[model samples]
Every structure is written in C-alpha cells, then in structure tokens.
Target: GSASGGPDEAVRQADRLAKDAGAPASGTAAAFVNAARELGMTRVSLATPYDEAQTETLAGYLRAAGFDVVRAVAGGPASPAEAAGWNAEAQAKLVREAAEPGPDGVLLACTALRTAAHIPQLEVAAGRPVLTANQVSVWEALRLAERRVREPALGTLFTVLPPVRG
Candidate 1:
C-alpha cells in the first residue's frame, strides 16, 4: 500500500546529516513545498513513470507538504532505464494528459524520467509552471545555499529568487 511520512522523514534525515557534517542543510521536500508556495501554487497536477502505488505515495507526500494534488498519472514504465529513455515528446504528452483543470502547476515526477530536458516545452504546453524532481532538487540546493535561481530554460521556478528568509 502507498504510505506517507517517508518524505518528511527523509527531509529530517537530510537536515540531521547536514548538521552533523557541519554544512548547511538542504531539505529537498521542504524546499519543494516552499518552491510551490513561492510560485503561489496551492494546487498541482502530477505525472510520473512509476506504478500506481509509487504515484500514490508521491501524491501523499506532496499533499502532506501542503500542496493539493489535483491529479496524478503514472506511466507505469517497466524499468528505470526505459523510463529514462522516454523522449521529450512522450513526457510532454503525459504531462498534458495529466494536466487537468484547476491545477496551478504541473509536476513531472521521477528523476529517472529525464524531465529536466523538457521542462520549458512542457510548461508552455501546459500553460503553467512545470516542475521535475531533479529541477526541484537543484532549486532547493541553490535556495538553501542562499543563491539566486536564474536558469530560464528550467522555467519560471528558476527565474526568481526563493522567498527571503528572515
């Protein structure tokens, strides 16, 4: 069955490791949630290459992190290698199909999906911001490091600075 709390725990563990290593902690899950919030996105659609259970788990994590997952679609790839080989056209098509009405953004889940290469096109096709796991991870790392995000090719998520920390 799909479960929750794993992502939250992962974030906690990353922070703990960073502290122990005497380095700045970069909480990926928290950073993803904050990225959505910074973009004024409270609702999002999701596309993944995992099976149903994994999709459900990811949706649950996103919901727990605060965004309402309005829709989620799984591509059900047989292997990570196959998923990684999925062309940008296929990825964009899946994203478009999963993009239902009322979603503030579209999330192309799974780092193995090779989504970073297609984020700009997907965003334009979906008419909204498109986020991928690797993209979000990089964004979070930059934000936690107090660096400005400015990669226009990665879509709007990288165009603006993260919310100023107090």
Candidate 2:
C-alpha cells in the first residue's frame, strides 16, 4: 500500500513513524532497493500489478534511492484479491516479460502476488536477480535482526547476506 504523499516523503514519514514507535520497519520499496543493492544491481526493471502512474511512482522511489530505473511495466489484476489469485506460472511470465535486457535485475512489486515459489526460475530466465515485495520484506526483516541464513529455494537474496548499514 502507498502513502498519501509522494514516494520520497512517504518513505521518510514511514521511517519517522517507525522510529518514534521504537520499532524497526522496512517498507517494501526500500526492501526491494536494498535487495537490489545487495545483489550488485545498479539498473533495474519493475513489474507491478498497478497502472502506469503507480508503477512510475515506484520507479521514482527507486530513482530517489539512487537506482537507474531502466524500464517499468504494469499489467496485472486490478485489485489485491485478483493479484493474490495469480499462480506461479503467471507470476513468472510477468517477471520474464519485464526482464528486458537493460536492467541488471528485475523487481516484481506487489505484496499480493505470490512469487516465493518461482523466483529461481524467473532469475534463470532473466539471467539476473529477481526481487519481489514479499521476498525482500523477509530479507530486510532478517537483516534488521542481524541474522543470515541460506535458503536457496527462495533465490539469490536468501543466499547472500545483507550489507551492514552505517
């Protein structure tokens, strides 16, 4: 879910709220960017279940975080329930389609889309890292806790330890 204001401000507000609450938080977009950075990705392509404008907002967020948004595409179920209905094959196809040659990695955005089961296959097809919302959330949570465990089935993010943040 997106906040009311622009992407950058939304992120800042979220962080501030989390800090005020004395809790750690990693927004999905931030987690996606972190996952991309950990995988050594500078250029990224995004695929989402939102319309073009929403997709561009996410791309803007990534750009604000210092990534080059090489490409962004959106075309999936219109609602969360519809996205949740997508199967692994459909999700894989969406990622693959967004895996245009320019990006070092692809970001499958949308927490509603189930992608934990197909990331490996999607990465192979894209020949690069594939970061998804849910996957990166898990990754950032583990990194916040300062724990790293290898779970190869979840794809490369799980295999590499997150970089230490200063």
Candidate 3:
C-alpha cells in the first residue's frame, strides 16, 4: 500500500520530507550583489536542473526579478532521483559553452541539484561569477551588509564587478 493523506497533510508531509531537499531559503540575493560587484559582471547566463518547460518558467521569473539570463542550459537530471546526477563534466561543459561572453553574472538553478559542489570549479572554468540558487540569495544578502567582501573560496562570490573609476 501507499501513503494516504489529505491535501494539507500531504503538503505538511512534503514540507517535512523536503526539508532536506537542499533548497535554500530566500536570502541569497544580498550575497549575490557582493558577488556581482566583486566579479565585475552585470549580465549572466542561466543553468538549470529542471526540464525545458520549467527552465522557461524560471527564466521568466528571473527576468521578472530583473536578472539578465543570457545563456540557457536546462535539465541537469531527469527526475528527482536523478537530481544529483547533473554530470559534473557534462554539466560543466554545457554551462561553459552556454555562457555568453562578457556578462555580469551566471546562475545555476535548482538548489536541490548539487551544483554548489562544483561552483568554484565552474567559476574558474567559465571565468565569471557563477551563483547557484542558494548562492544568489546569499550574494544579495552579503551586498546588503555594506562591506567589501571577497569570498575567494567561492570564486564567483569573490569576483568583482566592472571598475567604477574607469
């Protein structure tokens, strides 16, 4: 037999079970600002572990939020079971190729997708500021701190934006 419950109960159960889904809360934008400024990028590419349709929806959402997603990559894994299956080599290659040259930032979607593990490497390879779902919220938050932050370990987070004095 399978689990049975009301809609609300199901939702509650889902929320509980999904607590470990790896999706960070909404607070990365501040961190992202710092990342962007440090990285010296104003535009960015879009990478995702969701399907094409969902990716489109995400792109629209980001656009609505005022982020420019120049390059687009979708579907890191086929299903929830495969979420972490975002083949690092393939994914990195895809993202590298998809990224548009000369941008302010880069975002890899789906926090549950395990791309954060590759953030540093990806940034080095892409040679740009790369922020995943969770990282962006943090980035935005950090920018709000009113401090000059340089997160070298995170690579992209430490990247500075274009020179203002220039």
Candidate 4:
C-alpha cells in the first residue's frame, strides 16, 4: 500500500525499516535535495515523465526540501515503459525547453527515463548542472558508504566532491 500521508509518511516508514535493519536510512527524494544543495543550486527547472498531478507532487517535494522550482514540465508519458523509451535527444530537448534563464540547475526527475546517457549534453545545453534520479541515487549511496569516486563522463555531480554536511 502507498504511504498514507504521501512522501513524509513514506520517508518515516523508510527510516523505521532502516533502523529495524540497523542501517542508515536514505531516500531518493532526500538524495536529490542533498545533491542539489551540494552543487549549490538554489533554483532549478524540472523535467519529468509523469502526468500533471505527479509532477506537481514532485515539485512540491523539491520546494519543501528548500529548492525554488522555477520551471516544471511534464512529458505526460502514460507508463514507465514509455518513459524509458524516450531517447537521449528527446530528453535533452525537454531539459532545454523546461530550463529558464536563471535556474541554478535542471533536474530530470525519473529513474524510469533514460537520462544518464545524455546528462553531459543536457548540462551543456542547460548551461548548468543536470541531475538525473539514478545518478543522484548512486552518488548518495556512495556518500552514505563514505566512499568518493569521480567519473567525469557522469557529469559534475560525480566529478566534484559533495559539500560537507554538519
């Protein structure tokens, strides 16, 4: 069953489970926010493959995490399979289209969408950092494990060290 109170409840449940298992708790939502903060991104544009409602929820989550979502565009894909089928060029176009003049970064917000292959191109086009869900997840996992690895082809998120969190 879905969490009764949306993302907040989902996070709480994840924390509970992690504690029960004697492990650190981490969620993709928190990872995304932390990644953005690490990059010093205060404002961002969002590109998602979800419908209007899901997109709005995602934007709200980002907002609650302290990001200013200056622009948001949804591709309205009917299913995850459709989202995954989106090619690099199409995804780059969506990122470019959704990007505004002053956002600190552009976020491609779905793990289902094929985004990693095009992150470099998207970052160049957007003229800022471009973070995809899968990329951030990997980064966060490494961070939680106290491991640091740098691979430039994966984009700045990997190439640069994450900021220290108190």
TM-score of 3: 0.61
Model 3, C-alpha of 92: deviation from truth (Å): 0.9
Question: Residues 71-158, candidate 4, lDDT per residue (tens digit)?
Answer: 8888785488888898888788888888876698888888888777778888887788899988998898888788888887888898
Error of 4 at 132 (Å): 0.2
Cα lDDT tens digits, model 3, 1-166, are: 0012322343455456547664322233323333554555557677677677766665665454455767667754467557666666755775676566656656666655566567787777676666776666555545444434566665556555434553
The alpha-carbon deviation from the true structure for residue 76 of candidate 4, after best TM-score superposition, in angstroms, is 1.2
Query: Following a full C-alpha superposition, what root-mean-square deviation does model 4 have from the true structure?
Result: 2.7
Please, what is the whole-model Cα lDDT of each candidate in the order they appear? 0.78, 0.81, 0.57, 0.80
Model 2, 25-73: lDDT tens digits are 6577778877898899998999888888888878888887788888888
- Mark the regions of model 4 whose C-alpha exceeds 4 Å error after superposition: 1-10, 162-166
Off by over 4 Å in 1: 1-7, 162-166
Alpha carbon RMSD to native, model 1: 2.8
Give the candidate order by descending lDDT. 2, 4, 1, 3
- The 10-residue segment of model 3 with minimum total lDDT is 1-10
Q: What C-alpha RMSD separates each model from the true structure?
A: 2.8, 2.5, 9.1, 2.7
lDDT of 2 at 68: 89
Query: Which model is ahead, 3 or 4, in terms of TM-score?
Result: 4
- How do the predictions measure up, each by TM-score? 0.87, 0.88, 0.61, 0.89
Q: What's the lDDT for residue 146 in model 1?
A: 73
Task: Report lDDT (Cα) of residue 33, candidate 2.
Answer: 72
